[model samples]
Target chain A: MSVILPGDDLGISTDQIETSIGPGIYKVPGIKDTKLIPINGGLLNIQRNKQGTRQAAHLESNSRRYIPQVSDMVIGTIVGVYAEYYKVLLQNFLSNVTLSVMAFPNATKKNRPNLRQGQCVYARVSSYIPDLETELECFDLSTGKDGGFGLLDESGYIFDVELNYARELLFNPGFLVLEKLSTKCMFEIAIGINGKIWLKCGDGVPIPGKSTDEDSDKMDVDYVKDLKTTLAAANYIKQCQKVSPEQFDKVLAASFKGL
Target chain B: MSSLEVHAGVLGNSDGSCLYVVNGNKVITSVVGPIEAKARQELPQTVSLEVVVRPVTGLSNSREKLLEEKIRNLLQNIIIGFKYPRQTIQVVVQFLIADGRPEYTALELNMAINSAFYALVDAGVAMYKSFVSTVVAVPPEQGSSLIFDPSMEQIVASKSHHVVTYSVEHDECKIILLESNGLFEMKELKNILDAAKIQCLTVHEDVQRDVIESKLQQDYIWKS
Candidate 1:
């Protein structure tokens, strides 16, 4: 991989290998011919696949804005309610997307889910055009179910991550940090393409075996213990972001030992 | 050549930031957005860019506003704003130490331009090219004499000055921005411009080396 600044030409003379341009790469007219130039500052990576060798420039830092695309699943906060649609602010996107009331599963004029302001929803982009309002749907057409979409009950912690990191977490479900953490605790996690993650831990309250005078006391103690564990797990997940992939499992194990 | 000290990602809250020090002058630049744009300021075909320059001493006035406008125009040429339409990119530059030469404001502006470019790169903003800016001082009486990256005394003695920014495309240097003041003959102006271009090329090489070194350092950390 070569480090390339903007306007640095990729001197590829041969056309023997199929050349594909990826993000940050642009084709500009040269004196003799068109040359491939990087339009951003980043490291240049040449990847070889069945199709052929393709060049891409990857930036070290992530952009603040996220561009919406069709079929992209995103986590958004409901910002407004209207007669026909709900206004949602998706993470990293400046424009607000609208989720039609009819898009919800079994939604009707009278039987609609009362989505209020400040409520979070996980939905998919049904239609999107640049400079136009994006349309979102809660029900997955193929499954005909919520498919992890719809209004989120306020039971989880929401946090922002780098867009690239969120994509990695989604595609690499077996990522070491997530794999190790899942072994120690049960968690419900939603990874949004726009770099938002919603996570919640299962209620671990222990049930009292028999009716005793100290049953209430035991229940209170158990509740506190469960809450502590849940909070700790969430913190651990957040800290795992700083650890390199190679050291992730080791660091996770060390943290658990300390706990 | 003056020594350059660059510290990237210096601000925790900014999307990307850098502290650039050249000689005794220091400038800090922070980049924020592709973010929400005000309705009035929003552009439909391209992202809006806002550059704010804060001087070391007093509040920003008309002079600072002019500098901000120049920096913003230069950046607009480099950044691929059309890639992020309906958004805004804001660059805030604070001069920590001014060189104390009013006539050499061109040099300060050049430094601010270079610093802002680095901050934008650090923020991962899409740009067409990376540019370097240099200022050349040409004596008023003696048209033959030209000084590159002049000191305050040299600038004060010189009659005219020029600040030129250049970016490399296909290994060829191209001038992107030019600002000149004071009286000078055409031939003398050409001489100063040529010298400034060379200086900018050298600056570009130095910046590229710094970027590569930082990337290598990051890779080392991950590998280790």
Candidate 2:
């Protein structure tokens, strides 16, 4: 993979036997009738498979804001609750979604879940009618179960990561942060496709020999300490793709004591 | 000419920003957009592009407005406006420390254009192609030589000055924006354009190299 700028030419028709275009790429009509000039700024990827060679370009420098699509699992805060719909502010989207009262699990006319202002919920985008409004459902489509989707009650650390990074954290089975952290301590995490990550760990239990238990406000202090450590670990894992393995452990240990 | 020093993402609050410094002239640019637009300034089919040029001292005058218009038009052609309809993309260029000479206005404009381009790229604005521009001054006498990237003193002594912008595509250079002052024959103007095109390539390459290098540094830090 090579980094490309706005005007860099990927390849002409001559060298490229087949052409497969991806996002962040534009084709400019060239003087030669058979050739089309492909140019864009971002990361250039050339893949060779049984079919043929495919070239793609993607903007890899910064995380782009996420746009909601159908079936996207999003973590949003309840902004307002109406008679029929709940205004949910999504993580990265400018426009909010309307989560119907009936969308909640086991909800009836008079037995709907009590959702208050500024409450966070994990919901799935059921319908995304462009230019109108997005609709959300709290139940999973496959099992018709809650699937851990609902109001989050526990206090934890929330990090706003890049959209791509969030996706990687959610889908990638070999994600280093989860693998390393799970080995050290037990934790739970909810990854939003729109870049919001919620992480909760032990209930205010201080690590042995790490801190003094004499502080009366040990719980709050421990939570803060755990939040900071989790953030640092997440950041390090996000940057792991660029760091060498030998240097990774050293840097991670330096940033996090008792890694 | 002194070495050009360019720094991207300088302004913390802006969506995209850059600081360009060359020959004692420093221009800081910030871009904010694809955001909500004002009723009067909103465009139905395309994004509303605004360019604001701030001088070193006092308020922006008509001269600055003229420069702003030039940049706005140039950006409209380069940026994919239709992608962000009914929104606004505001570009603000501030002269932190001007060279303090009247004749260097062309140079200032060149720097402003370059800085704006980098800021837009940083902001992740979809551009058709980035442009590079340069200023050259030619003497009053018919046979006098043309000066590339003329200083304040050279510009004051010269009779004609030209600021030309070139965008490269498929290894071919095409002029995208041209602003010239003073009188010159058709052949003389063509000569200046040719010279400016060559100079623009060097500047473009320098910028391209710096941008890639910086991106690599960021990738190294954030992605393994």
The TM-score of candidate 1 is 0.84
- Taking the tens digit of each residue's C-alpha lDDT, what string does model 2 give over A123-221? 889997544567999997788779889886545556666565677668877656567656555567788887777776654224446555566665665
TM-scores of all candidate predictions against the true structure: 0.84, 0.80
lDDT of 1: 0.75
Q: Give the Cα-based TM-score of candidate 2 against the true structure.
A: 0.80
Clashes of each: 0, 7
Worst 10 residues of 2 chain A by lDDT: A32-41
lDDT of candidate 1 over A1-259, digit per residue (tens): 5667777776654356656666667765345654667776666666666765543333343444576778888899999899999999995436788999999888889888889999899899999876677899999889888878987756566777756567667876556556777887778888788878877666433335634255455555555555556566666666666656677667666656644
Worst 10 residues of 1 chain B by lDDT: B215-224
Docking class of 1: medium
Error of 2 at B200 (Å): 2.0
Candidate 1: TM-score of chain A is 0.75
Candidate 2, residue B223: how far the Cα is off, in Å? 2.9
